[model samples]
Target: MINAFMQARTGSTRLPNKVLKNLQGLPMFIQQAKRVQRAKLVDNLVIVTSTDESDDIIEQLCNENNLLCFRGSLSNVLSRYFHAELNYPCDAIVRITADCPVIDPELMDYVINSHLKNNNDYTSNCLVATYPDGLDIEVISKNALHNAYKYAEKPSELEHVTPYITSHPDKYRLQNIQSEQDLSAYRWTVDEPKDFELISSIYENLYVKKPNFNYQDILELLSHKPELNLLNPQIARNEGMVKSLKKDKEEGYE
Candidate 1:
């Protein structure tokens, strides 16, 4: 059984104290957790957060909800994940960020099932999904993470979590889950003021009627309101070192 690592925190340099922010009456982390918990493939969910003083509230929230939570290095995220693997009944780990409240459960099931069926060491679609900004999910074996903890030497590897494993295909099997639809224009992640506005706009238009709507529904809604996609033209970029290395090697840079 793979445990879902709902890695989250209260600290964000760009959007400080955003995770606890309410989205349509629910805390952002709770909304994210609710989505992941609805996924059929996840056996358990553990929210891995930082030990930062601000995150104490997160621990309290997890406790109140009876959801598993762990706190470790504020920046060294790999240690947080390592501790999660040690403490949980987790064969694999599903990486979910706190910022994305609109995470898709169907996408989560697709990636988790694919990872299990193909036996890939690590699997994700958002890396390639291009389904807009927030529909990313990472599933990886606990062993693969241990390998990353042992080998990936970069500072970002520890701070940024599983990029080292996902980027390095030579070290482990990697898979990309993508949607047939090009939802590349929607802004679903809450990183900047514009992003928050776009998300709030979605809720204003949809949440009153449908709270459990999927990614495709949101895409369709945003397509009708094209201006919503333009709220944040450039969301956060996924700069995986392994992916960067592959790109460099392909270009014969080294």
Candidate 2:
């Protein structure tokens, strides 16, 4: 089964409980899932979260919304995903994060189709990233995930949950989906206060008018009002991953 395994937690230091924040009346997590559910290629949508007490609310939210939920290790996310696939019948595990409420379902189907057509061990939009940060997508075959679990042991690999497979590109048949335009400069992920402001503003301006808005709708909105980009342009891409990599070296997690 093709499962979109969304990773989330309530322990974000930069933006505490950001997943639960309201986006057009629904929590950002729920809103993101609502969009993901529309992907025709995805067989099931599941929330893969941590087992920490703080994350119990995530499971509760998933229960209320009728989303399949799985709780595992807090820090070792790679292992969590590996086991999630084991317990659930996930053939193609579509990796998603809860922070991206602007996720496009058609784009998700494109990524999944690419994975199947290429017969790749692992495929993602992030490898050569043409999409904005929050729109990241990763589709890993069951074999690829099993291999990652068997070989990856570094703290950053465990924490980031795909660094192992992504790092060892030579070992895995990796495919990167890219857009014709290099739109990498855009930042749509929610990691800080400014990010939340940016996302909330986007929802306020677009959600009510077009409940199922896609990338074009957002592009048009931003084209008319470029000021939205300034809300969090200062933040770098994968700031959390960079920090984890640095901390791993200092704390002897290598």
Candidate 3:
């Protein structure tokens, strides 16, 4: 079975409870979860969050929505993922983040199909980042995830799962699914207030008309109103990973 695990928490420093922020009367994470459920390749979807008291509300939300959830480490997200897989074993795991409220289901199925067809140990569109930041997706084999859990030591590797597998390419087969056109410049992730505003605007414009809006729909919207990109202009992608790398260097894990 292919299980999609969404990493979530309410402890975001840039925007606390950002996942709980509403879009079309549903929390941003729920909206993303609902979209992920539409993927034909995914057999199960689980919301993986930390076991901190701050994340209690996340668990409560999962219960209220009847969504599957797993609670684990607060800082060590790799450990969280590893344990989540231990409890809910699957053939391969799909890693997603809660910050992406506008993630496309069709795009998810495409990458997952590639991963299974190629027999890759790891597969992702963001390996080269041809797609938008929020639409990033990763598929890792069960064995690869186990190796990462057992061997990863750096702060970055522990905080951001799959870095260990990507770093040691010789140990595992990796594949990257790319888009026909490079749309990497577009930012659809929610990390800060401005990001939230941009995503809110996207939902307001698209969600009511067609609830299952894809990345193409978003691109069309941007083509018409180019100024929407200005809402969260020039924000660096993977800022959290950069911060974790900084911590790794400080701790002599580099």
Candidate number of the best lDDT:
3
Ranked candidates (lDDT, high to low): 3, 2, 1
Best by TM-score: 3
Listed in order, each prediction's TM-score against the native is 0.90, 0.97, 0.99
Name the better of 1 and 2 by lDDT.
2
For residues 1-254, what per-residue lDDT tens digits would candidate 3 score against the true structure? 99999999999999999999988899889999999999999999999999999999999999999999999999999999999999999999999999998989999999999999999999999989889989999999999999999999999999999999999989999999988999898899999899999999999999999999888999999999999999999899999999999998999986
Clashes of each: 1, 0, 0
Ranking by TM-score: 3, 2, 1
RMSD per candidate (Å) reads 3.8, 1.3, 0.7
| lDDT winner between candidates 2 and 3 | 3
How high is the CA lDDT of each candidate model?
Answer: 0.81, 0.90, 0.94
The list of candidate 3 runs beyond 4 A from truth reads none
- What RMSD does model 2 have? 1.3
Residues 1-254 of candidate 2 have per-residue lDDT tens digits of: 79999999999999999999988888899999999999999999989999999999999999999999999999899989988998887778999999998988999999999999989888989998799888999999999889888988778888888888887878889999998888888888899999999889888999898889998788889999999888987788998889889978887876
Residue lDDT tens for model 1, 65-139: 889998888767888888888888577999888888889888889888999999999988766656776777888
